[model samples]
Target: MCQRCEEPERPEEERYLIEVLDQIRENGWCVQGVLGTGSRPSWAYTAGLTAQGLPELVVTGLLPHHAARLLNAAAEQTLHTGPPVPGEQWLLPRLPKLEIVQLSAPAAHLHIAVCCYGAGIEARQLVYADSAGRFPWSPQYNSGRGGQPVLGVRHA
Candidate 1:
Protein backbone atom coordinates (compact mmCIF):
# COMPACT_ATOMS: atom_id res chain seq x y z
CA MET A 1 0.00 0.00 0.00
CA CYS A 2 1.12 3.58 -0.55
CA GLN A 3 2.34 5.64 2.39
CA ARG A 4 -0.63 7.93 2.09
CA CYS A 5 -2.99 4.97 2.33
CA GLU A 6 -1.11 3.66 5.29
CA GLU A 7 -1.67 6.93 7.13
CA PRO A 8 -5.30 7.63 6.38
CA GLU A 9 -5.68 10.16 9.16
CA ARG A 10 -3.76 12.88 7.36
CA PRO A 11 -5.62 13.00 4.10
CA GLU A 12 -5.00 16.70 3.48
CA GLU A 13 -1.33 16.44 4.33
CA GLU A 14 -0.96 13.39 2.16
CA ARG A 15 -2.63 15.09 -0.74
CA TYR A 16 -0.35 18.10 -0.45
CA LEU A 17 2.71 15.91 -0.25
CA ILE A 18 1.58 14.05 -3.34
CA GLU A 19 1.15 17.30 -5.17
CA VAL A 20 4.61 18.47 -4.23
CA LEU A 21 6.12 15.19 -5.28
CA ASP A 22 4.28 15.24 -8.58
CA GLN A 23 5.49 18.75 -9.33
CA ILE A 24 9.05 17.81 -8.52
CA ARG A 25 8.81 14.79 -10.75
CA GLU A 26 7.56 16.84 -13.71
CA ASN A 27 9.45 20.08 -13.11
CA GLY A 28 12.90 20.27 -11.63
CA TRP A 29 11.60 21.93 -8.48
CA CYS A 30 8.44 22.95 -6.64
CA VAL A 31 7.81 26.51 -5.62
CA GLN A 32 5.85 27.30 -2.45
CA GLY A 33 4.60 30.71 -1.42
CA VAL A 34 3.86 32.05 2.05
CA LEU A 35 1.74 35.13 2.38
CA GLY A 36 3.14 37.68 4.75
CA THR A 37 1.52 38.78 7.96
CA GLY A 38 1.17 42.39 9.01
CA SER A 39 4.67 42.43 10.42
CA ARG A 40 6.31 40.13 7.91
CA PRO A 41 7.06 40.25 4.20
CA SER A 42 5.77 37.65 1.77
CA TRP A 43 8.23 35.03 0.53
CA ALA A 44 8.56 32.21 -1.96
CA TYR A 45 10.96 29.27 -2.04
CA THR A 46 11.89 26.19 -4.03
CA ALA A 47 11.34 22.79 -2.43
CA GLY A 48 13.02 20.26 -4.74
CA LEU A 49 16.37 21.82 -5.59
CA THR A 50 18.04 20.11 -2.65
CA ALA A 51 17.24 16.80 -4.26
CA GLN A 52 19.31 17.96 -7.23
CA GLY A 53 22.18 18.77 -4.81
CA LEU A 54 21.43 22.46 -5.02
CA PRO A 55 20.41 24.55 -2.05
CA GLU A 56 16.79 25.69 -2.24
CA LEU A 57 16.23 29.26 -3.36
CA VAL A 58 14.23 31.84 -1.38
CA VAL A 59 13.17 35.34 -2.34
CA THR A 60 11.16 37.72 -0.19
CA GLY A 61 9.32 41.05 -0.70
CA LEU A 62 7.99 40.42 -4.20
CA LEU A 63 4.61 39.16 -5.31
CA PRO A 64 4.15 35.41 -5.38
CA HIS A 65 4.27 35.12 -9.18
CA HIS A 66 7.38 37.28 -9.43
CA ALA A 67 9.11 35.29 -6.74
CA ALA A 68 8.23 32.03 -8.46
CA ARG A 69 9.65 33.26 -11.75
CA LEU A 70 12.89 34.29 -10.08
CA LEU A 71 13.19 30.96 -8.27
CA ASN A 72 12.49 29.02 -11.48
CA ALA A 73 15.08 31.01 -13.42
CA ALA A 74 17.62 30.58 -10.66
CA ALA A 75 16.96 26.85 -10.52
CA GLU A 76 17.49 26.57 -14.28
CA GLN A 77 20.73 28.51 -14.05
CA THR A 78 21.98 26.33 -11.24
CA LEU A 79 21.32 23.24 -13.31
CA HIS A 80 23.85 24.56 -15.84
CA THR A 81 26.32 26.55 -13.70
CA GLY A 82 26.04 24.66 -10.42
CA PRO A 83 24.79 26.12 -7.17
CA PRO A 84 25.88 29.59 -6.16
CA VAL A 85 27.93 30.18 -3.07
CA PRO A 86 26.80 32.48 -0.32
CA GLY A 87 27.94 36.07 -0.82
CA GLU A 88 27.99 35.61 -4.59
CA GLN A 89 25.97 37.87 -6.87
CA TRP A 90 23.74 36.55 -9.68
CA LEU A 91 22.55 38.60 -12.63
CA LEU A 92 19.54 37.21 -14.43
CA PRO A 93 18.51 38.79 -17.72
CA ARG A 94 16.05 41.71 -17.29
CA LEU A 95 16.10 41.44 -13.50
CA PRO A 96 17.88 43.21 -10.72
CA LYS A 97 21.17 41.82 -9.48
CA LEU A 98 20.58 39.29 -6.72
CA GLU A 99 23.00 38.51 -3.95
CA ILE A 100 22.95 34.98 -2.61
CA VAL A 101 23.15 34.60 1.13
CA GLN A 102 23.01 31.35 3.01
CA LEU A 103 19.89 31.32 5.17
CA SER A 104 20.89 31.54 8.80
CA ALA A 105 17.61 30.14 10.09
CA PRO A 106 16.19 27.92 7.40
CA ALA A 107 13.94 26.17 9.89
CA ALA A 108 12.28 29.39 10.91
CA HIS A 109 11.46 30.66 7.41
CA LEU A 110 11.44 27.69 5.02
CA HIS A 111 8.64 25.54 6.40
CA ILE A 112 7.97 23.78 3.10
CA ALA A 113 11.62 23.01 2.47
CA VAL A 114 11.97 21.75 6.00
CA CYS A 115 8.88 19.58 5.58
CA CYS A 116 10.24 18.13 2.34
CA TYR A 117 13.93 17.78 3.23
CA GLY A 118 13.87 17.73 7.03
CA ALA A 119 15.76 19.88 9.54
CA GLY A 120 19.15 19.73 7.80
CA ILE A 121 17.93 21.22 4.54
CA GLU A 122 19.91 24.18 3.24
CA ALA A 123 18.65 27.30 1.47
CA ARG A 124 20.00 30.54 0.07
CA GLN A 125 18.17 33.83 0.09
CA LEU A 126 18.20 35.84 -3.11
CA VAL A 127 18.46 39.40 -1.83
CA TYR A 128 17.45 42.08 -4.30
CA ALA A 129 18.16 45.77 -4.27
CA ASP A 130 15.76 48.66 -4.34
CA SER A 131 15.08 50.74 -7.42
CA ALA A 132 18.09 52.91 -6.64
CA GLY A 133 20.26 49.80 -6.58
CA ARG A 134 20.80 50.07 -2.85
CA PHE A 135 20.75 46.86 -0.88
CA PRO A 136 18.72 46.33 2.29
CA TRP A 137 21.69 46.97 4.51
CA SER A 138 22.30 50.33 2.93
CA PRO A 139 21.40 53.24 5.12
CA GLN A 140 19.51 55.02 2.37
CA TYR A 141 17.70 52.09 0.83
CA ASN A 142 14.04 52.85 0.28
CA SER A 143 11.48 50.39 1.56
CA GLY A 144 8.45 50.31 3.78
CA ARG A 145 8.45 48.57 7.11
CA GLY A 146 8.92 44.87 6.58
CA GLY A 147 9.07 45.52 2.86
CA GLN A 148 11.98 43.16 2.27
CA PRO A 149 12.80 40.56 4.85
CA VAL A 150 16.38 39.37 4.56
CA LEU A 151 16.43 35.76 5.65
CA GLY A 152 20.18 35.70 6.01
CA VAL A 153 23.01 37.81 7.20
CA ARG A 154 24.75 40.03 4.67
CA HIS A 155 28.31 39.10 3.93
CA ALA A 156 30.60 42.05 3.34
Candidate 2:
Protein backbone atom coordinates (compact mmCIF):
# COMPACT_ATOMS: atom_id res chain seq x y z
CA MET A 1 0.00 0.00 0.00
CA CYS A 2 1.08 3.62 -0.57
CA GLN A 3 2.52 5.46 2.40
CA ARG A 4 -0.65 7.38 2.73
CA CYS A 5 -0.43 10.78 4.41
CA GLU A 6 -3.29 10.67 6.87
CA GLU A 7 -5.66 9.38 4.21
CA PRO A 8 -6.26 13.04 3.21
CA GLU A 9 -9.48 14.92 3.84
CA ARG A 10 -11.10 14.33 0.48
CA PRO A 11 -12.03 11.03 -1.06
CA GLU A 12 -9.50 9.12 -3.13
CA GLU A 13 -10.88 10.64 -6.32
CA GLU A 14 -11.15 14.21 -5.13
CA ARG A 15 -7.79 15.15 -6.71
CA TYR A 16 -7.11 17.82 -4.11
CA LEU A 17 -4.87 19.21 -6.80
CA ILE A 18 -4.80 22.71 -5.45
CA GLU A 19 -4.22 21.66 -1.88
CA VAL A 20 -1.40 19.28 -2.68
CA LEU A 21 0.24 21.44 -5.32
CA ASP A 22 0.05 24.52 -3.13
CA GLN A 23 1.70 22.57 -0.32
CA ILE A 24 4.47 21.54 -2.69
CA ARG A 25 4.97 25.17 -3.66
CA GLU A 26 5.35 26.08 -0.02
CA ASN A 27 8.52 23.98 -0.02
CA GLY A 28 9.95 26.48 -2.54
CA TRP A 29 9.12 28.92 -5.31
CA CYS A 30 6.15 31.21 -5.25
CA VAL A 31 3.25 30.15 -7.43
CA GLN A 32 2.42 33.01 -9.75
CA GLY A 33 -0.29 31.31 -11.73
CA VAL A 34 -1.69 27.94 -12.78
CA LEU A 35 -2.41 26.98 -16.35
CA GLY A 36 -4.51 24.30 -18.02
CA THR A 37 -8.11 23.89 -19.02
CA GLY A 38 -9.01 21.39 -16.31
CA SER A 39 -7.59 18.68 -18.48
CA ARG A 40 -5.92 15.46 -17.44
CA PRO A 41 -2.35 16.80 -17.59
CA SER A 42 -2.79 20.45 -16.79
CA TRP A 43 0.17 22.46 -15.55
CA ALA A 44 0.64 24.80 -12.59
CA TYR A 45 3.63 26.57 -14.02
CA THR A 46 5.75 29.48 -12.75
CA ALA A 47 8.49 31.06 -14.77
CA GLY A 48 10.06 34.47 -15.38
CA LEU A 49 8.82 37.55 -13.57
CA THR A 50 5.76 39.03 -15.15
CA ALA A 51 5.17 42.75 -15.50
CA GLN A 52 3.39 42.56 -12.17
CA GLY A 53 6.25 40.99 -10.19
CA LEU A 54 4.54 37.65 -10.34
CA PRO A 55 6.20 34.55 -11.63
CA GLU A 56 5.44 34.05 -15.31
CA LEU A 57 4.43 30.75 -16.83
CA VAL A 58 7.13 29.35 -19.01
CA VAL A 59 5.88 25.77 -19.15
CA THR A 60 4.97 22.65 -17.16
CA GLY A 61 3.04 19.12 -13.49
CA LEU A 62 2.85 13.50 -9.80
CA LEU A 63 2.59 9.71 -8.00
CA PRO A 64 2.43 5.98 -8.27
CA HIS A 65 4.88 4.55 -10.77
CA HIS A 66 3.81 7.11 -13.32
CA ALA A 67 4.25 9.93 -10.86
CA ALA A 68 7.47 8.45 -9.58
CA ARG A 69 8.88 8.30 -13.09
CA LEU A 70 8.02 11.92 -13.71
CA LEU A 71 9.52 13.05 -10.43
CA ASN A 72 12.63 11.00 -11.04
CA ALA A 73 13.07 12.44 -14.49
CA ALA A 74 12.81 15.96 -13.13
CA ALA A 75 15.13 15.22 -10.25
CA GLU A 76 17.69 13.68 -12.54
CA GLN A 77 17.59 16.70 -14.80
CA THR A 78 17.98 19.20 -11.95
CA LEU A 79 20.59 17.31 -9.95
CA HIS A 80 23.62 19.46 -9.11
CA THR A 81 26.94 19.01 -7.36
CA GLY A 82 27.54 22.61 -6.25
CA PRO A 83 26.03 25.73 -4.79
CA PRO A 84 25.46 29.19 -6.33
CA VAL A 85 26.71 32.44 -4.86
CA PRO A 86 24.51 35.48 -4.56
CA GLY A 87 24.01 37.39 -7.79
CA GLU A 88 25.18 34.36 -9.68
CA GLN A 89 22.80 33.22 -12.33
CA TRP A 90 23.02 30.07 -14.46
CA LEU A 91 22.36 30.26 -18.15
CA LEU A 92 20.33 27.38 -19.47
CA PRO A 93 21.71 26.96 -22.93
CA ARG A 94 19.28 24.14 -23.50
CA LEU A 95 16.13 22.97 -21.86
CA PRO A 96 15.68 19.28 -21.36
CA LYS A 97 12.78 17.69 -23.17
CA LEU A 98 10.16 15.85 -21.10
CA GLU A 99 7.88 13.07 -22.14
CA ILE A 100 4.39 13.21 -20.68
CA VAL A 101 2.86 9.89 -19.81
CA GLN A 102 -0.80 9.30 -19.17
CA LEU A 103 -1.91 6.93 -16.42
CA SER A 104 -5.31 5.39 -15.93
CA ALA A 105 -7.77 4.46 -13.18
CA PRO A 106 -6.77 3.18 -9.70
CA ALA A 107 -3.19 3.55 -10.81
CA ALA A 108 -2.40 6.54 -8.65
CA HIS A 109 -2.76 9.54 -10.97
CA LEU A 110 -0.70 12.57 -10.09
CA HIS A 111 0.86 15.53 -11.89
CA ILE A 112 4.29 16.83 -11.03
CA ALA A 113 4.98 20.05 -12.87
CA VAL A 114 8.59 21.12 -12.99
CA CYS A 115 9.88 24.02 -15.06
CA CYS A 116 13.10 26.03 -15.38
CA TYR A 117 12.79 29.64 -16.43
CA GLY A 118 14.76 32.95 -16.41
CA ALA A 119 16.89 31.80 -19.34
CA GLY A 120 19.32 31.13 -16.54
CA ILE A 121 18.10 28.42 -14.24
CA GLU A 122 17.11 24.82 -14.01
CA ALA A 123 13.95 23.65 -12.29
CA ARG A 124 15.76 23.35 -8.94
CA GLN A 125 16.45 27.11 -8.61
CA LEU A 126 13.06 27.33 -6.99
CA VAL A 127 14.21 25.63 -3.81
CA TYR A 128 16.39 26.64 -0.85
CA ALA A 129 19.70 25.02 -0.06
CA ASP A 130 19.84 21.86 2.03
CA SER A 131 21.72 21.61 5.32
CA ALA A 132 24.86 20.63 3.40
CA GLY A 133 24.51 23.76 1.23
CA ARG A 134 23.44 22.11 -2.01
CA PHE A 135 20.87 24.15 -3.99
CA PRO A 136 22.05 27.60 -2.76
CA TRP A 137 18.73 29.38 -3.30
CA SER A 138 17.28 31.00 -0.20
CA PRO A 139 13.52 31.34 -0.03
CA GLN A 140 14.06 34.55 1.93
CA TYR A 141 16.50 35.81 -0.69
CA ASN A 142 14.18 34.86 -3.49
CA SER A 143 11.27 36.62 -1.86
CA GLY A 144 13.15 39.62 -0.51
CA ARG A 145 15.17 40.14 -3.66
CA GLY A 146 12.84 39.53 -6.56
CA GLY A 147 9.76 39.11 -4.43
CA GLN A 148 7.29 41.78 -3.33
CA PRO A 149 5.18 43.78 -5.76
CA VAL A 150 7.39 46.10 -7.76
CA LEU A 151 4.55 48.08 -9.29
CA GLY A 152 4.26 44.91 -11.33
CA VAL A 153 7.65 44.83 -12.92
CA ARG A 154 11.22 43.64 -12.34
CA HIS A 155 13.64 46.28 -11.11
CA ALA A 156 17.28 46.38 -12.01
Candidate 3:
Protein backbone atom coordinates (compact mmCIF):
# COMPACT_ATOMS: atom_id res chain seq x y z
CA MET A 1 0.00 0.00 0.00
CA CYS A 2 1.18 3.56 -0.73
CA GLN A 3 0.15 6.74 1.03
CA ARG A 4 -0.25 10.02 -0.78
CA CYS A 5 0.49 12.60 1.88
CA GLU A 6 -0.92 16.05 1.23
CA GLU A 7 -2.64 19.04 2.86
CA PRO A 8 -5.86 18.52 0.84
CA GLU A 9 -6.09 22.15 -0.24
CA ARG A 10 -5.34 21.73 -3.93
CA PRO A 11 -7.33 20.06 -6.74
CA GLU A 12 -4.36 17.98 -7.86
CA GLU A 13 -3.99 16.74 -4.29
CA GLU A 14 -7.43 15.17 -4.38
CA ARG A 15 -6.84 13.73 -7.84
CA TYR A 16 -3.58 12.19 -6.73
CA LEU A 17 -5.29 10.60 -3.77
CA ILE A 18 -7.73 8.86 -6.07
CA GLU A 19 -4.93 7.69 -8.29
CA VAL A 20 -2.99 6.32 -5.32
CA LEU A 21 -5.94 4.28 -4.13
CA ASP A 22 -6.49 3.00 -7.64
CA GLN A 23 -2.88 1.99 -7.95
CA ILE A 24 -2.98 0.19 -4.62
CA ARG A 25 -5.95 -1.78 -5.83
CA GLU A 26 -4.23 -2.61 -9.08
CA ASN A 27 -1.09 -3.70 -7.18
CA GLY A 28 -3.25 -5.90 -4.92
CA TRP A 29 -2.04 -4.13 -1.78
CA CYS A 30 -4.78 -4.03 0.85
CA VAL A 31 -6.31 -0.72 1.87
CA GLN A 32 -5.36 -0.21 5.51
CA GLY A 33 -7.06 3.02 6.55
CA VAL A 34 -7.43 6.63 5.48
CA LEU A 35 -6.68 8.25 8.82
CA GLY A 36 -4.59 6.89 11.65
CA THR A 37 -5.92 7.01 15.21
CA GLY A 38 -4.52 6.23 18.66
CA SER A 39 -1.07 7.72 19.36
CA ARG A 40 -0.86 9.30 15.95
CA PRO A 41 -3.63 11.67 14.79
CA SER A 42 -2.96 11.79 11.09
CA TRP A 43 -5.02 9.76 8.67
CA ALA A 44 -3.78 6.17 8.55
CA TYR A 45 -2.37 5.06 5.24
CA THR A 46 -1.32 1.60 4.19
CA ALA A 47 1.97 3.06 2.99
CA GLY A 48 3.73 6.05 4.51
CA LEU A 49 7.05 7.61 5.46
CA THR A 50 8.75 6.51 8.62
CA ALA A 51 10.23 8.96 11.13
CA GLN A 52 13.39 8.33 9.16
CA GLY A 53 13.38 9.89 5.66
CA LEU A 54 12.60 6.88 3.50
CA PRO A 55 9.63 5.70 1.51
CA GLU A 56 7.57 2.89 3.03
CA LEU A 57 5.66 0.39 0.97
CA VAL A 58 3.54 -1.00 3.76
CA VAL A 59 2.37 -4.53 3.31
CA THR A 60 0.05 -6.30 5.64
CA GLY A 61 -0.93 -10.00 5.82
CA LEU A 62 0.84 -10.89 2.62
CA LEU A 63 1.97 -14.49 2.10
CA PRO A 64 5.65 -15.15 2.69
CA HIS A 65 6.21 -15.68 -1.02
CA HIS A 66 4.61 -12.37 -1.91
CA ALA A 67 6.59 -10.57 0.74
CA ALA A 68 9.82 -12.13 -0.48
CA ARG A 69 9.05 -11.14 -4.05
CA LEU A 70 8.47 -7.51 -3.06
CA LEU A 71 11.62 -7.41 -0.95
CA ASN A 72 13.66 -8.98 -3.72
CA ALA A 73 12.55 -6.31 -6.14
CA ALA A 74 13.55 -3.60 -3.68
CA ALA A 75 16.96 -5.18 -3.16
CA GLU A 76 17.59 -5.41 -6.88
CA GLN A 77 17.25 -1.65 -7.30
CA THR A 78 20.02 -0.70 -4.88
CA LEU A 79 22.15 2.29 -6.03
CA HIS A 80 23.76 1.79 -9.41
CA THR A 81 27.56 1.75 -8.92
CA GLY A 82 29.93 3.99 -10.91
CA PRO A 83 32.97 6.23 -10.45
CA PRO A 84 32.55 9.81 -9.25
CA VAL A 85 32.45 12.45 -11.95
CA PRO A 86 35.30 14.99 -12.09
CA GLY A 87 33.10 17.78 -10.77
CA GLU A 88 29.76 16.27 -9.75
CA GLN A 89 28.58 16.09 -6.16
CA TRP A 90 26.35 13.68 -4.24
CA LEU A 91 23.63 15.13 -2.04
CA LEU A 92 21.93 12.21 -0.39
CA PRO A 93 23.23 12.37 3.18
CA ARG A 94 22.48 8.83 4.27
CA LEU A 95 24.16 7.58 1.14
CA PRO A 96 27.86 6.87 1.17
CA LYS A 97 30.22 9.44 -0.31
CA LEU A 98 29.02 9.47 -3.89
CA GLU A 99 30.88 7.72 -6.67
CA ILE A 100 30.15 10.08 -9.59
CA VAL A 101 30.79 9.23 -13.22
CA GLN A 102 30.86 11.19 -16.48
CA LEU A 103 29.32 9.71 -19.61
CA SER A 104 30.52 9.84 -23.21
CA ALA A 105 29.11 12.02 -26.02
CA PRO A 106 25.50 11.83 -27.20
CA ALA A 107 24.37 10.78 -23.74
CA ALA A 108 22.86 13.42 -21.47
CA HIS A 109 24.81 14.30 -18.33
CA LEU A 110 24.09 11.83 -15.54
CA HIS A 111 24.51 12.09 -11.78
CA ILE A 112 23.96 9.10 -9.53
CA ALA A 113 24.11 8.86 -5.74
CA VAL A 114 24.43 5.57 -3.87
CA CYS A 115 23.29 5.08 -0.30
CA CYS A 116 26.39 4.19 1.73
CA TYR A 117 24.84 2.52 4.75
CA GLY A 118 26.49 -0.89 4.51
CA ALA A 119 27.99 -3.36 2.06
CA GLY A 120 24.91 -2.74 -0.08
CA ILE A 121 22.05 -2.38 2.33
CA GLU A 122 20.42 1.05 2.62
CA ALA A 123 20.27 2.41 6.16
CA ARG A 124 16.74 3.52 5.43
CA GLN A 125 14.47 3.33 2.45
CA LEU A 126 13.11 6.59 1.06
CA VAL A 127 9.37 6.84 1.40
CA TYR A 128 7.32 8.23 -1.48
CA ALA A 129 3.75 8.96 -0.51
CA ASP A 130 0.98 10.44 -2.59
CA SER A 131 -0.10 12.92 0.03
CA ALA A 132 3.53 13.79 0.79
CA GLY A 133 3.98 14.87 -2.86
CA ARG A 134 7.75 14.27 -2.92
CA PHE A 135 10.81 13.71 -0.78
CA PRO A 136 13.32 16.49 -0.06
CA TRP A 137 16.40 16.74 -2.27
CA SER A 138 19.83 15.78 -0.93
CA PRO A 139 22.55 18.42 -0.66
CA GLN A 140 25.32 18.12 -3.24
CA TYR A 141 28.91 19.32 -3.30
CA ASN A 142 30.75 20.83 -6.25
CA SER A 143 33.85 18.83 -7.28
CA GLY A 144 36.33 21.53 -8.23
CA ARG A 145 39.68 22.21 -6.55
CA GLY A 146 37.83 24.86 -4.57
CA GLY A 147 34.45 23.35 -5.24
CA GLN A 148 31.48 25.37 -4.09
CA PRO A 149 28.64 23.77 -2.19
CA VAL A 150 25.44 23.50 -4.20
CA LEU A 151 22.62 23.03 -1.78
CA GLY A 152 19.90 20.75 -2.99
CA VAL A 153 16.41 22.20 -3.40
CA ARG A 154 15.15 19.70 -0.80
CA HIS A 155 16.00 19.81 2.86
CA ALA A 156 17.64 17.06 4.92
Per-model TM against the reference: 0.89, 0.22, 0.20
Error of 3 at 100 (Å): 24
Give all candidates' CA lDDT scores.
0.85, 0.29, 0.27
Candidate 2, 5: how far from true, in Å? 5.9
lDDT (tens digit, per residue) of candidate 2 on 87-144: 3333332322222111111111112232222332222222212233332123453333
How far is 149's C-alpha from truth in model 2 (Å)? 30
Residue 33 error, candidate 1, Å: 0.2
Off by over 4 Å in 2: 1-5, 8-15, 18-22, 30-44, 47-53, 60-91, 96-156
**Model 2 reaches what TM-score against the true structure?**
0.22
The list of candidate 3 runs beyond 4 A from truth reads 1-10, 29-72, 75-156
Tens-digit lDDT string for candidate 1 (1-156): 665676668777767787788889899789999998877789999999888998988999899989988888989998899988888988898788889899998878877778788989888999987778877877776754337778888877
**Worst-scoring 10-residue span by lDDT in model 2:** 147-156
lDDT of 3 by residue, 1-156 (tens): 433344345576456556654654465322233232343322111221111233222211233343334333432232232222233434432322332222121111111011111122112221221122222222222112211111212122
Which scores greater on TM-score, model 2 or model 3?
Answer: 2
Q: Using TM-score as the measure, what is the rank order of every candidate, best first?
A: 1, 2, 3
